[model samples]
Target: MTIRAWPSRRLGAGGLAAGALALAPVAAAEALYVPEAEPVADGVYAIIGPTDARTYENHGMNANYGIVETGEGVLLIDSGPTAFSAELIEEAVAEVTEAPIRWILNLGVQDHRWLGNDYFQREHDAEVIAFEQTVRQQQAFATDHLEGRLKEAVQDRLAGTEPAYADRRLPGEEATLALGEVRLELQRTDAHFPGDAMAYLPEEDIAFTGDLVYVDRMLGVHPWSSVQNGYEAYQELAALDPETVVPGHGRVSGMDRVERDTGAYYEFLVHEVGAAAEDLAPLQEVVERHREEPAFQHLEHYEGWHATNVNRAYLEFQQ
Candidate 1:
């Protein structure tokens, strides 16, 4: 109902900042909030979030979640940051359908995707489903990073949150399900993250690509991500030719928009980073050089992640 963007901590120039924020209530200083739940298609409600990450304002509601009201029950796309955030999502879904949540498909293992799992399982007895790799990564997040790496940064919003993991693990292969009359498709793409998955409703011609596509923000590549693989993942998604593409962050857009933006980003990395690796440039020099490039210089919050992405791919190419 209320929304705004807020800033989180960034250690230094190289420290990554969460330019994105979650959708939450309007507060005194919070600016990045999830705008509102609106229908993008017949049964699909988009809880589009602020195109940022855990911030003081959003209270950690950065990731978007899709709710599909079906004959059986509601299908939740991804769990949010905390129990309170999930409750907000419940409010959004209630606006559309009163059916209880049946299942939740986690799109990735990021802090945003699975932390709210505890709330969903407790409230609706929903089964959390994710790719096998995602399940492992989720466990790692809980056991290793939950309190270690992320605690202080987001603890303010993670209050009521406990780690709830996936109960079902699906293979990272293309799979389809018949949700009543709506045809649902899950395609695995090892782009943004190893276990990243995308959901598509063929009947409605609407596709939800986890983080593989960012409409207007700087596309981040995880330390383990591959530019080559990420580019390939984009190609597969572009081929689907969906009328409306729901990106992991940012607004929903057409295929051409994402393909043009993200497609160009990866292409630049594959060539530039690959060349830097081949030329045996000093690691620090290569990272510094890429950060000043035309593409990296002008994107929304590009400095926060562009160098990291370039170095990760460069190291991969050298190996």
Candidate 2:
């Protein structure tokens, strides 16, 4: 699952350039299929998946979930996109270990994080844990956005199913949960979202970074006013030295690869967007010009989201 960082400009070569343009719309309609969980280290597993449908104002990439097996119980990281996928994850975990799933540490409050809460809670009595900010986002999603465009995109897959929201929250910089010999560390970060968090299993040298580190893709900018903190959030994640890095989306990779590739994407965004800002260019032109950047090149299939990311970066640049 190692992702090498290539120059964004090189994506123009071969059929990638034309293919990106052709597949943009088709990619948005497709839901990322869940991948089987694979062991990254002893007792630490990565739940990898394909690129999710691009619909939201943000959330351009799919997410990867993590699971840690310990003597006491199992610690599950971010839930998949829907309740159906979440249940599958639960069944998969059960196959390997009978220990109850004690804690579900949500890295953020997006659908990928909390929608699966009901499934885990009802079946394993697992506690849904997340940053306080994450809880707030969860409420916002439920009351405001979850049932709208978000639901419409995956309604077929969720047919006749409802997701349960969590009732509890974790607050501040750090929290630790002891699952047998493994200590799961949840560290708060402000990268992809206000409540963004990362989970680390020290004994296994694995860290599950929610959307904070988007591997092999463009980093999503926050849409809120005066917020360009996503880049800073990436720095915070780099500070946590882990051997294996499981991202919110894309393949799991070595810590070095995660840091290098994610950092490169951030730096590229800053440079490309900053240049556009300096020229006082419109958001669309900026996105159009940089469509060839490696971070965004493969995402030609997700052009619908380009406007959203561009708007976010444009606002941040102005502030």
For all predicted structures, in order, the TM-scores are 0.84, 0.76
Candidate 2: C-alpha RMSD after superposition? 10.9
RMSD of each: 7.7, 10.9
Backbone steric clashes in candidate 2, count: 4
Worst 10 residues of 2 by lDDT: 6-15
For residue 225, what is the lDDT in candidate 2?
Answer: 18
Give lDDT per model, in order: 0.75, 0.64
Tens digit of per-residue lDDT, candidate 1, span 1-319: 3653333322123223545223223463344354367788887888878766566556566667788877788888898877757776776787788888888989887777778889889878998888888887677667554675456556666676888888887766677776555678887777777777788888888888887777778888877566777788787777888999888887778987776668788888888787888889888888877777774454566868887888888888888
Alpha carbon deviation, residue 261, candidate 1 (Å): 2.7
Report the lDDT tens digits of candidate 2 across residue range 203-296: 7777788877766654556463123455666666667677778887767887666766566656665667765776689877786777555444
What local lDDT does model 1 show for residue 20?
Answer: 29
